[model samples]
Target: MQKPRLIASDIDGTLLDPFEQITVRTAAMIRRVIAADTPFVLVSGRPPRWIPPVADMAGLDGYAVCANGAIVYDIAAARVLSVHGLDALVLHDVVHALARVLPGIKVATERAEPGPDSAGAPFATEPGYRNPWGDAESNVRPRAEVLGHTATKLLVRHEKMTSEEMSLAATELLGDAVDVTFSTNRGLIEISAPGVTKARGLAEVAELVGVARDAIVAFGDMPNDIEMLRWAGHGVAMANAHAEVLAAADEVTAPNSQDGVAMVLERWF
Candidate 1:
């Protein structure tokens, strides 16, 4: 494998533990990676509003590829450098499509605005869509209000089916018109613009940081991280990652609970 110059990792299941905190070993190892002159980019399925705290927790302020691929955030400045989002019509159409296939699915929109992160500046999501990461500041607006404008990302959730099941049900209904992925193993799916993935977001970061794609290594444990892992020089899957994620990886590390990311970085650094 090429000696990597950049390191990109997915946040929830790949970097953060079950409780959403970076372990001491992981933090120390990330410090080591940055010390080795390689930027540690947090490529996640999170909205831009959620990046700062995670970066602060890691004690690293490298770039973050957030909202699947719709946002490229500069964590140090707490600003969005770029965004690729779905317009109101697109999201409305998606809601209709999913509603047809899966009845009563909850829809949440992370709008691109001000006051916080990305276009979903303050985050105006619907009531049924709980913030999976325990968000404290989401505006529980009506579903109509949430879908009234363009959004950096759209979140859909169902009371029953797992994310994979939801994906299967929406497969024909959603062909390649958009990018759909799940960070968690539950009934939630995050949607971004067509062809947008964390890999694209990281590409923007690469251009800014002057790191070649082949000189980068990435880690992930969910469908959202699939393209990113495949796009990197080394795509590592966590031992407890989804089956598709495992198949997509060049190697498999320990589970997140075991500090998988830190283990790999320790060896490289």
Candidate 2:
């Protein structure tokens, strides 16, 4: 097989181990790939603020496709190259529609604060929104207030529905107006602007680096990563990936705990 010119991998459950740390072997492989002139971009549903540390862990400081394809971040420079955010009016419309369809749903918006440094409370959740991660950076407000402005991503949760169910319902109701996908198995769904996805984000980076889709190898392990996995020339799903993700992938590698990404890259790098 021809070696890939670029390597893109999801962070949480694909690159990081169960402990949420990059293992020595994996880091070594990442550095080796870069040393060989291969660009490794971290494509994830995580916001830009959360990408730098992970990039540091992997000993890389290039570009990262963040917020499920909503933002392109430059790691070393700590700058956001671009953002395809959800407009305020559109967010309000989507939230209202979702609330009607999925009763008892809660909403949150992730706004990309202006300026280079990602300061301030960019995450706002509506009342009754249960934060699964107990994030301290979140601010609680009324539902209307939460959806009253533009955002990088809109997060919705329903106590009675799994992430998959919410994603399906949102996709059905919203159609092409927005992109719906979930990164975790928890009862939460991440919504972005129409056509915003990790695939789209990675494509932008690929064009910047002059790598074609046929020469890119991507790795992921969640439903949010399905589009990216399918968009790359080689889509590799981790062994522990969601069923939907596994089905979408061109091949399966070891689980995150076993350094799935490194396993696949070693073959080419």
Candidate 3:
């Protein structure tokens, strides 16, 4: 492969190891890649608040595509370069539709705080909806307060349905009015504006950085990463990737715990 111009990677199960930390070897590999003048962009289902810490771990000042593809973040500037958020009206409608179809469903919206403290991304979620990991610096409030404004992404959860099942259901009900995807945690579905995905976010970054689609390499391990993998010239899946992601990828690497990302970059940098 002709060396990649832009390297896009997913966090959690893709870049960080099982411990959710960037290993020293992985950090060294990232530094080497950055030294070669390649831009590393983190595209994740996470909010911008979770990105700065990961960028620091990589030992580079990089940008991020947060909330799936809804927000593009400039890490060093601590600014949101662009955002594709659901309109307030649309958000309200979708929530109602989901409630009608899935009674007692939990709804939460991820709002980008003015900033983060020693605390991490200041998330405003509904009272009952916790993250996939069961831990986040989340502020739980009444649904009235949570759904009153436009948001980057919405989390829809049900006690019985996995995110995968919820994703299928939401897609069937909402169709193109909204974009629905999920994470490793199958408990909740994350909603974005129509047509937004990791690929769309990466495309924006590639344009901003002047990298062609063919020269971009992306790594991912979930259904959310499907479009990004398809969009990249070299789309790699983690060995532990979801079945859909593994099938969509051009290649599969070792598990993230084994420094799969670093092992691949070594071949290039």
Candidate 4:
């Protein structure tokens, strides 16, 4: 493969190991890439606030595509460059739609206020909502109030359905209204505005930096990463990636536990 002009990677299961830590070797390789003047962008399903620690660990001080591509953030600057969010009305429609398809669905919303201090933006979840990641800062509000405002992304989970099942139900029910995908193996499904995806966010950044799609190499490990993998000039999927993600990638590398990202980068940069 040709030398990448820019490197874009997912955070949770692609760049971090099984323990959610960036190994010395991986960090060193990432720093090496930056030293060679290539822009390394963190593309993730995580909200903006969740990106800082990961960036700090990898020693990255650049841009990130957050909220599964609904947001573009500058890490070191602590500013939101742009946002493609879901309107409150659309979110309300989605919630009602899902409730009809799958009873007892819980909803959460992520809305990052635009500008330098998005870290304090509200993350609202309804009562009885179970945040698997243990987010204590989220405002536990009534579902009506939570769905009354625009959001960068919407998270919905069912008490009895799997993530895959939720994805299918949302896709068939909310087609063209929202983009549905899941980053975790659990029951939660993430929803974004139509056409908002890691690929869309990365494309916006590539245009800003004067890099073409063919000059970028992206790595990921989940269904949410599928569009990005297919969009990049060369897409590498970690061996431990979801089945659809593996099929979407151009090449498969070692799992994240084995430093898969670094393994692939070593051969090129």
Candidate 5:
């Protein structure tokens, strides 16, 4: 196969180690890829608020896929180039419906906003409410009051519930109105705008950079990354990746602890 001219990777459970930091080997390999004129984009389920720091640390100036592709951010410009958000009406209905069915769930919403006045600001913000089930004495606000605009994504966290269980519950509740997946091994569910996926975000980045999808190499380790891994010309699955992710990739590299991303770049670049 021809060498890739672009590289996109998921952050948690893929490129970043368990501590959520890039290793020296990974940083060096990223530098090598950039020096070769191959741009690497960080595609994550994280909100835009948490992407810039990671980009700065990696010395990347490209786009970032945040909120599981609901938003595409330009790191250098500090702006959002594209956003696929859930319709306000749909979001309200979904949130309310989910709450009614799954009580005690914690709902978190992420949205784009101006950077902080201080230097090195984090883009976007997360402001929402928490409501526990069977707590009639609680004074939690309504879901509408908590969500003011189009919600880029909704995060549901429940300590007693498993990620898979929450995901299944969300799917059953939202159905075709949204896309739901697990962003972490812990019990957290990520909800994205319908039709938004990591693969879609990477495609937009490829178009913006004038690179063919076939010239992109992607790496991932979770179910949310399956589409991206399959979309790239060279799909790499981390050794610690889930079985589905491993099966969808063209190859498997070492785990993040072993600098899997660096290992791939060292050989390919």
Candidate 6:
């Protein structure tokens, strides 16, 4: 098989291990690929602030499809290359309407905040429940007053309800105005701007890099990653991936705990 010129990967459950850390083997493989001038993109539902550490760890200096494709970020430059956001008015209306339907549910907006380093701002003051990826102490903040900034994505966290239930409620309430998907197993729902997704984000990155969509490979392991996986020339789903993701992909790799991404790189490179 012809090797892809670019690789895009979802972070949480596809590239990272169970503890959310990238394995040494994966890191080395990423570095090797980057050294070979292959652009490795980290396409994820994570906010811009939470992406740098992962990018740095992987030795990638390309763009990140953040907030499920609501924002495409130039990671090396620490700037937003493009953004698809919900207008302030629409965001407020949706939040309010969702609150009425699912009382006590946490509603948070993920945005780029000024960071302490040259890597740009991290996701600041997410208003919803704690981050479900075990980074609660870093990403969680107290509920605060909502403002009128453009929202890259809206996150809903419900303790007693399943993500499927919350997603259905959101669809019923908001209809086609927003796109919703879940990346974690913690019943959190991520709502993005209509028509925006990680696949679209990868397309944008591919355009900027002058790489064709058919020259890119992608890895993912959840429902949120289905479109991205299907969009790539070679889509690889982790062994532990959702059925939908597995069915959509071109192939399956080892589980995340076993360094599935690294195994693919080893075999391909």
TM-score of each: 0.93, 0.96, 0.94, 0.97, 0.87, 0.87
Q: Write the per-residue lDDT of candidate 5 for residues 116-231, one digit (tens) a residue.
A: 45242122222333323222323344556445566677667676787778888889878878888886656678778888899998899899999998888899999899889888
Which candidate has the top score in TM-score? 4
lDDT of each: 0.84, 0.90, 0.86, 0.91, 0.79, 0.80
Per-residue error at 91 for model 3, in Å? 1.1
Question: Which wins on TM-score, candidate 1 or candidate 5?
Answer: 1
Query: Can you write out model 1's per-residue Cα lDDT over 1-269, one digit (the tens) per residue?
Result: 75589999999888999888899999998888888888999998777767888888887776888888788888887778888989988888899889988997988887653335334344777887766556576788887778888788888988687888888777667989988888875788888889999999988999999988888889999998999989988899999899999999999999999999988877668
On lDDT, the candidate that comes out on top is: 4
lDDT tens readout by residue for model 4, 1-269: 68999999999899999999999999999999999999999999998878999999998998999999999898888888999999999999999989998899999999975765445446899998887777677788899989988899999977677899999988998887889999986789999999999999999889888999999999999999999999999999999999999999999999999999999999777
* 4 against 5, candidate with superior TM-score: 4
Per-residue lDDT of model 6, residues 1-269, tens digit only: 48889999999888889988888888889988888898989999887877899987777778888888877887888777787887667777787888899987876676654334534223434454665665554444454433255668777788788787787788898888888888765768888888889998899899989998888889999888988888888899999998889899999999999999989888667
Work out how many backbone clashes candidate 2 has: 0
C-alpha lDDT (0 to 100) for residue 217 of candidate 5: 88
Ranking by lDDT: 4, 2, 3, 1, 6, 5
TM-score-wise, the better of 1 and 3 is 3
What clash count goes with each model?
Answer: 5, 0, 1, 0, 1, 4
| Model 4 TM-score (2 dp) | 0.97
Off by over 4 Å in 3: 113-122
User: Candidate 6 — which pairs collide?
Assistant: 49-122, 49-123, 113-121, 115-121
